[model samples]
Target: MRGEEMNFEPMMKMMSLSSIGLMIWIAAQTFTPPKEVVVYVEVPAPVVVTQVIHAPISTARPAPRPDSLCLALNIYHEARGEPLKGQVAVGQVTLNRAAVAYKGASSVCDTVFARKQFSWTHEDPRQPSGAELRPSLDLARKILAGRYIDRTHGALHYYNPHKVDAWWADSYAEVAVLGNHRFMR
Candidate 1:
């Protein structure tokens, strides 16, 4: 018992790809925004990343495959406290941005993770994958499936009026006010 030493390095170094920190680093190094993105699933030993799939962005008015996990993450982080219609509005803005290559990003992931666009992206993304994530995912699918109404009124930009007076806000035309955000076109 006197010479017992617990090895903690293994616990400390689990998986690098599991964290959004690495993803942020990779995103920064990547200059060009892609039309699609590939996400990896971490498996047990000998199989670091098991599956690689293309993240659906946009195809038609109602996308053939409208559900993108990337889009869901944005809604979850940006409008977690917002109501159902509010969440859909936020999702619409993200889609609006991607449709027009806002901030030089074409894909949902790129637009969401764009430098300084969304505050949450710059911070730590713990990568929560559970029931708590369902609301956003469901909303993402619904909005993209052409089911939910466009509460944003085709607005391409939005911001919380109470939070900060964004300089750019003065320029865009404010279209809708839902929950805690002001949607602009």
Candidate 2:
């Protein structure tokens, strides 16, 4: 009986040793290190855009009246052989007349578009009165001061009699105002 029991113990020991060896082999195969790989890729360069710019405003101060006034004064003075002061005075008068355009009731509408009142002189009979004349006169004054001729091209008021005379009397109808009587006939 003792011998049989000892034989059984050795058999059990062999079985346990075989199971441990099988487990170690399985663990080693399952835990293999990951393989290393090398790859190449191409990338493109960045793109650029362009844009227009305007000139900066001038810092130099401007004269009170329009620059045209200065130019006209220069030309008039040079042509007639007059002093610069006379040219400047001419510009000033244009500004001044524009300022007090509605002094009289008849002159009130002096700057308006009424044809009947339209005269060769500053005093137009058909000129607007009171509030009606104010806005138009004010605008006219501004235009004159700015040296902007309302029409594309025309005589500067009735100041130059020569221009008025050169145009036919019937042509006066087309003009906003005829030149002063001296020029109109």
Instruction: Let me know the TM-score candidate 1 reaches against the reference structure.
Output: 0.60
Model 1, range 1-185, lDDT digits (tens) per residue?
11222232344247554554454345435523344433333334565555433333232234323336778888988888888778888898888888889999988778887898887788897776658887787777787777877778789888887876878998989999999999989
Q: What's the lDDT for residue 21 in model 2?
A: 44
RMSD of 1: 16.2
Candidate number of the best TM-score: 1
Q: Highest lDDT: which candidate?
A: 1
Number of colliding residue pairs in model 2: 4
lDDT, model 2, position 115: 42
Instruction: Tell me each candidate's TM-score.
Output: 0.60, 0.20
Give candidate 2's whole-model lDDT.
0.32
